[model samples]
Target: MKYFRVDLITATPNPQRCIYVGMHQDYSESFVGENRINWPDEKKAGEICVKRLLAGERGHYGPMEHVQIVFNIGWFPHSVMQQARTHRIGVSFDVQSMRYTGNRINQVAKGLLDIEEVFYLRPIGHYVDRKGRRYNYTQTQRNIDLQYCEQAAKRYYDLIEDGFAEEHARGILPFDYRQHFIVSFTLRGLLHFLDLRSKRDAQLEIRELCRLIWPHLENWAPEFAAWYQQKRLYKARLAP
Candidate 1:
């Protein structure tokens, strides 16, 4: 939780109004952008879009694709990105590549970066897996995992120093190494992603990623976020 984050990079200004404009364009005989004088303000526009673009009888979503936001995701494990990438339609990602970057591994090997900063382990706590089996990830097991990460980093760095390519040397690194990525999504795409990753059965770390993304969505488009929170958040209500 300490390292995981979602920072907003940029978003469409008056995104709710932009969504409404798209909706207006779909039906208006006249051009919508040219009729901005009659368009609703951001909040009002958000309300209108939710009602017209996504409400029960008028379940239109094409206009939601018109609004977009970008984020810089930080320090989530590589596995999180792996899971996040499964739903790629209308989504874009530029992830930190271990193949081209080995400074963090070197830093860990040199005792500059803490092992935990380079790898992930679940906190020592009880957890139940998909089947009804329950178990505890104790402190001792976690300590062993930390040691494993340190050893892997050292081996990876040693291989690099011995003229191994970064890509070749990285084979020894842990699967859940920390990584950062830049991602952008259309509003509809964002909703579709949340529908999958924010559900009860989703992996815990990826759910955390979805949790982190929500605040930025709310701040940028309050009305849409509100509608989503009430009707869709965590319910696995797949966005159409």
Candidate 2:
């Protein structure tokens, strides 16, 4: 369908400063709230945060939990959500549910929406399997798959038209129906998610999701993102 996008909903402002305060509070006996008046700039705070807390892989992730970010993920396939939910760790999701929101399906049935707009299919290409088997997904195969999706969508809509419940009618829909969702994570959780999903072995769609998320993180916490890009990104978890 040529659409997968992420929009930043909200994030803790001055995240590096938050991290610095959290990290600094851990070792300080005084009330950090008052002492934070002397806190450095976010960039410098992030540099110090990296130096003091993450430089040698200190394994101190508590500070990162203080910063929170949320995103509205749009037009990703159900499979991506399925895969991401499997390893959610400490993330939260508020997905568009078929049971409650079926306007797009109705649109498809009324010919107001293209099936391609409501569903996702991998483009014709060579893709690798978990066993390292590389196979070409031909256009012929894709067309056949498209037909199956079309049939399924027709059935789903027809059932709905016949007074079937959304919960029941949704059972006939394509497995890869495009969905929008809201997801939130702490700074540490976000990096850990990237560690797991941005790897070379991860599914392509979710990997693309992580790719879209990275820029937002970079803009939010430049120093932390830079350190993560150099160390943890697509390599290994920064901590247990």
Candidate 3:
């Protein structure tokens, strides 16, 4: 199984500056001119922006929409990507098409070669039980699952080689098959995504993905990230 990857491609040139500009739109009268307003102290501006966001001030979140972050993610299971696409507002995605890539199994005259090397997500349930106890799949069960996947891959290859279109052949692929995509999201949308997907109750795969991505976001906006961590606002909806 291949490890999931999330690569930060790019982000807003000056995230804090963008937020400050939006804040200034509401408080323009407070400054004499654009030159008079604090121009380059992003740390200080980020601090003020974080304050407003934490305090529930009007228009604070609206400014976050201007700061965008982009990522190139890959080798994650298809099910996780499908779930991720539900965050349609303020986010964009360009996913790899199975119709174009086809099933990527290696074939040999004897049988499927490198079947053990095929990328698939390990079943988390095999390692941990519902109560968080360590659990191991019986060897019999493990072999059955592996054989099933190998047979499926073989059938996929056979279908493609026998004149089936790539799109039709992809129907045999499992949800655990690895996939890739490029995705972008505004700061506000990203925060919303983390708030929902990073929770303890979220699917293990996506929760892990969010945890891996969180540190990079924190590095980009320390003040706001601190506020988010301290407040635990991600669980606010679960509160009574």
Q: Note the residue pairs that clash in candidate 2.
A: none
Q: What is the C-alpha lDDT profile of model 2 across 52-154, one tens digit per residue?
A: 9888888678889999999999999999999888765688999998999887888877778887888899989999999999899999999998888777877
| Candidate maximizing lDDT | 1
RMSD of each: 1.1, 1.3, 3.7
What TM-scores do the predictions have? 0.97, 0.96, 0.84
lDDT value, residue 14 of candidate 2: 98
- Distance from true position, residue 172, model 1, in Å? 0.9
| C-alpha root-mean-square deviation, candidate 2 | 1.3
Residue 63, model 3: Cα distance from true site in angstroms: 0.1
Which tens-of-lDDT digit does each residue in 156-187 have in candidate 3? 88888799998888787665777788989888
Candidate 1 per-residue lDDT, tens place, 1-240, comes to: 878989999999999998888888878999777877999999999999898877673558888888889999999999999998886558999998888878999999999998888898888899999997999999999999999999999999899999999989998888999999999999989989998999999999999999999999999999999988888888987776
How many residue pairs clash in all the candidates, one count each?
0, 0, 0
Relative to the true structure, candidate 3 reaches a TM of 0.84
> What's the true lDDT of residue 204 in model 1?
92
* lDDT values, one for every candidate: 0.89, 0.88, 0.72
- Whose TM-score is higher: candidate 2's or candidate 3's? 2
For residue 116, give model 1's deviation from the true position in Å: 0.8
Instruction: Rate residue 104 of model 1 by lDDT.
Output: 93
